[model samples]
Target: MRWINILLGLAVAGILGFYGIRELLADPVYFLELFLGGLVRGSIYALIALGYTMVYGIIQLINFAHGEIYMIGAMTALIVASVLGLWGWHSAVIAILAVVFAVVYSCAYGFTVEKIAYKPLRTAPRLSALISAIGMSLFLQNYVMLAQTPEFQPFESLIPDFAFWEPYAHIITSVELAIIITTVVVMILLGMLIKFTKIGKAMRATAQDKIMSSLVGINVNNVISTTFVVGSATAAIGGVLIACHVGQINFFIGFLAGLKAFIAAVLGGIGSVPGAVLGSLVLGISESFFTGYFWSEYEDVFAFTILVIILIFRPSGILGKHETQKV
Candidate 1:
């Protein structure tokens, strides 16, 4: 099975490369545009997928409500920006404040959700926790809908264009460039945090063995809550960036975004951070090409098809380890 998967993966890669090179030669500009567009999309997905991957890595539980948290972040930012804009604040300042508020609110919500919906169920069956996550997702969705209108809200782009980059603006907008750069910086900082910080060390230990970590004097609860907080922060940034790019947002936006990010996480091996980013980029680029060359309406169909293929051939994900369980 492993050999078969390897062969199939190689074949798919070769086919894609052949077609990609041909398309690049045929229309370099169009191809580059699609590639950049996909990169922007993948950056947003990577932000949200980080949260999904982190939580799953530590607890082995899928937090469905995570999407709601992302929505809340965007919604919060929209509200903040609207209020500030009415006061005639500068767009850059408004953006910074809005993002700060979004991160704070989203982190609060993430931490609260863990305590309220997941912590008590930590020792319970995985199904119970999963169902709780779903319920929380629904609750947050309706809560926001009632609090804010169900109608789509306009989100002004906070990213300012650089005068020096005018020549290349047609290929990638300032907003898209900002999103990509921000995702990269965040990923780098996150890598450092996970690799060097005391809390990061604690998180790694807990993910490896919760009981042993606790026995070793690490505060397991704090580590779990911290993970939730950090994940929420990244998702919030993604929400804001995407809203800025799309120019409109509704209560339901996070659902599709979160679902796609989850698929990316699974694709890259859910528990691995690097894997999540790689998976998101691959998914984003492939989707871009599919929509550009084929039917755009079936993009979701294509995403799921990839998911199914990965599940069948590489369930551990591209970067995930194959673990063996002993009876």
Candidate 2:
């Protein structure tokens, strides 16, 4: 199976490379611009994918409200920055701080959601748990609509414009650069925490088997809650970056982003961290290329089409493992 995956990957890469070479020959500058744009876009997707993968790893359940959590994070940051009267450099600092605060708040919300909605249903049927997730998602979305205005509002400018180094090509905006840098830093820190920390070990143990982990004296509930917190925090960061990039937000901001990030998670392999990153990059780059070379109308189609093909050929996902049930 691994060999099959390797071969398939090579084939796909070869096809893409061939087309890419043709495009480069036709218009090198344009190709470079598209590639950079894709990377920036992929950073946002990767940030959101972190949340989905983390929650799925620990609980084997998708937290559908994650997107809403992200939406809340952006709103929280925006509100906080506005309250602080932050603009330019000060505004940028406030925005970053606000995002950090939002992450903390979102983490708390995630922990609460797990305790209130998921923990009680842990021993229940899987379908019941799934329904609960859906209900929680709807509740969060509606809660925002009721508590906050549904209309789109512009985000306050936080960072001053920096001079562009690329005179011929202006592919990388300051917001795009910030998104890429922030995503990389967060991912690196997370990777380190998971790889070299005691809590990380506990998380891995709990993910493998909760009952066994509990029996072994691990605080299974705490680990589970921590997992949710981590996932939600990452999602919150993603939301902030996305809002800053687009310069607007609304009550339903999370719906489409969440769906896309979910697709990215599945495409990369749900349980694998690196898979999520790779999947996001592939999805982002593909979408950008299609939109750049073809038409914007086909952007969404291109992403979903790739997803369908991936599912048809590799149901377990590109880097996902297939679990065999013992009957």
- Per residue, candidate 1 scores C-alpha lDDT tens digits across 74-158 of 9999999999999999988998999999999999999999999999999999899999999999999999999889999889887
In candidate 1, which residue ranges exceed 4 Å CA deviation?
Answer: none
Candidates in order: C-alpha RMSD to true structure: 1.0, 2.6
Q: Which residue runs of candidate 2 sit more than 4 Å off their true CA positions?
A: 1-14, 86-89, 163-169
Candidate 2 C-alpha lDDT tens digits along 121-175: 9889878888998898899888888887878989865554666644532767787
TM-scores for all candidates: the values are 0.98, 0.92
lDDT of 1: 0.95
Query: lDDT values of the candidates?
Result: 0.95, 0.84
Best-matching candidate per TM-score: 1
* Model 1 lDDT-worst window of ten: 318-327
